[model samples]
Target: EPEVTQTPSHQVTQMGQEVILRCVPISNHLYFYWYRQILGQKVEFLVSFYNNEISEKSEIFDDQFSVERPDGSNFTLKIRSTKLEDSAMYFCASSERGVGELFFGEGSRLTVL
Candidate 1:
């Protein structure tokens, strides 16, 4: 089955540096989303994109963050300035049905020093 895939399972970065997390969502999925889990915290939604535009976004998606579909198969998230609080496991998810269950990637772990 097709699945979402994220690169660089772990990353250690310095504060204020920019980081780009990469993801390849399922080929036929119609909805894509980004969520983060702070170590032991519950998953928090960052943004959701559909039809080539943002469908929903949470407060966590601030000026420092951005998302884009750079190609037919890749979905990317860029953080302009890293902060200690930004340390978390960022997961990429996709679903064929808009309201159906989402399939998640293993996640890219971000660590800011």
Candidate 2:
């Protein structure tokens, strides 16, 4: 069995700084997504990507945020500016089918100071 992998398991950054989170999904999966969970808060969907383009995005994925699949095997999320509200556990997930179960990566925790 394969799973999604995330880099920089933990990140500590000053407010207003830039941050990029990277993830690699299972080789055979197609649908990829980025989701976040603020401490003690519910997991929220940030964005979904397919066919190298954004398929869906939530209000949280504003102008300050962007995602890219720079290559066949990796997906990345970049935050132009860090805010206290942005501090959260970011999870990367992928699914073979568009509406089925999503295999998730161990979250990358971001702490904004």
lDDT for 100 in candidate 2 is 75
In candidate 1, which residue ranges exceed 4 Å CA deviation? none
The TM-score values for the models, in the order shown, are: 0.97, 0.97
Residue 87, model 1, lDDT: 99
Cα deviation at 103, candidate 1, in Å, is: 0.5
In candidate 2, list every pair of residues with a backbone clash: none
Model 1 lDDT per residue over 1-113, tens place = 77799998999999999999999999989899999999999999999999899999999999999999988999999999999999999999998978979999999999999
Candidate 2 vs. true structure, TM-score = 0.97
What is residue 79's positional error in candidate 2, in angstroms? 0.4
CA shift of 40, model 1, Å: 0.8
